[model samples]
Target chain A: MTQPLPMPVTLLGYGAATLTTLSFFPQAIKTVRSGDTRGISLRMYLLFTLGITAWGIYGLLTGDGPLIVANALTLVPALVVLERKVQSLRRGDDRLW
Target chain B: MTQPLPMPVTLLGYGAATLTTLSFFPQAIKTVRSGDTRGISLRMYLLFTLGITAWGIYGLLTGDGPLIVANALTLVPALVVLERKVQSLRRGDDRLW
Candidate 1:
């Protein structure tokens, strides 16, 4: 069992991870509930989801538990938002329907 | 004089960092150019900006160059988007005007 980071550092890492991962909830919920993505940028979600996937891969390769968990959790709602964004774009609806 | 990761791993880390950081550009650009945030969740940006700031500080404390650079660059556009979101909410306008 190797401790890659000091205890305090590890705590900070977890805190940072939790914050970033949990931050996605509001956007996801809003998108799912309202089905609105007008203000959301298609390119942004496209790139962000891909980036998060890469981060997850990086975590896997490095065997970092927190990174793996954080990125994985974040990916779900991100995908939800991305899916909704695409749907919104497809429908050609500007305002909430 | 410490190499924390192997060359290949370092490359992957850099790639991951580049992706996640660059992902913010589209959202920021869209918000700035369109001045629309109806679909954007204010809570999401608020929490995300704070998280990114924490991540940047964590990088600084950990002496991780890539993390520091990535988070610092990410913080700029993120703040831009966040500020616009706040402004949009304050104005109580739904459509792009």
Candidate 2:
């Protein structure tokens, strides 16, 4: 049988999950502020967002709170960047490096 | 008491983790092939790499095999891209958008 995680491990997992999820914030903010996503790769973000969504589903099914929390938070910024990327592409903005 | 994850959920988690880790492979391969990371953000990658490391640690501590496997696979490509990013920066390659 699987044992419950120790308190320290749980804490670490939560902390790590929070940091990882928050890491996407800067990019989201940059995209929002500059209204530029020319440098961001659409394919990469699309795949990543999808992957995260799958991970979130996995988390929910497993009842892994850390995974659920992290992926849920990550989805917000990922979607934002993704939308902006698509918008920029439609606008004929070729500034994406 | 916490229950062990169902087999399907575990499978889904593993599958998601594998896909996510593999997703980074393209960027790593591209960077290696082109020897250019100019468009890649250094700070962004650095933080991401660190976050992944932390997540890996959390995974190890919690005995979350899915997290461990995913992050371990992810680290290989992440470090490669990260190293290339730093190398390009030092070489004065500004192509990173």
Candidate 3:
């Protein structure tokens, strides 16, 4: 933890993290802008956020900066979707696809 | 690269991998069985799979077994959803929400 990662490795990790993290954006943006929850599954996202949290914890334990950063970014959009799903499901307006 | 990760770290890594990897199951399962991709987004999943591939490459470069394994598991279900989205989009049966 004392030393910085090699440049290439750092770049790779950050690039990977950014791509993966932002991968959730389109859906999250759509959800926020439109308020549609037809095909998204509530259980899936519940597991997803929890999984992301675990990954962030692992990253912390392992001193992997990209892992932590990526999960943190990814988690935000995912939670947005999750929150919408929770709202829809609560209203009994859930889609069963 | 030669030495194995510490046991507790390895356990934590694997546990994180397993949880995050399986998070896509419910939606993928639903997509496969019911062919309902109404809520899924093609652009979202295309980016997702690419992001996962990037992560896997990063794992390979870093010699991180848990990273590789986790992304591998996560990719399968994501691709399934992507495939369905592609199909639906191709058919012009896409849902715009």
Best by TM-score: 1
Can you list the residue pairs that collide in candidate 3? A39-B39
TM-score, candidate 3, first chain: 0.80
Q: Rank the models by TM-score, top first.
A: 1, 3, 2
TM-score of 1: 0.88
Better of 2 and 3 by lDDT: 3
The candidate with the higher lDDT, 1 or 2, is: 1
TM value for model 3: 0.83
Could you give the interface RMSD of each candidate, to one decimal?
1.4, 2.7, 2.2
Q: In candidate 3, which residue ranges exceed 4 Å CA deviation?
A: A1-10, A95-97, B1-10, B95-97
Tens-digit per-residue lDDT, A16-72, candidate 1? 778888988998998888777887887778888888888888888888777788889
* Tens-digit lDDT track of model 3 for B1-97: 3466789877876776777788799889877877768767666888889888888988887777877888888899998899888888788887544
lDDT of each: 0.81, 0.75, 0.80
* Highest DockQ scorer: 1
Tens-place lDDT per residue, model 3, A1-97, is 3466678876876777777788899888887776768678777888889888888988887787877888888899999999998888788887644
Shift in Å, residue B51, candidate 1 = 0.7
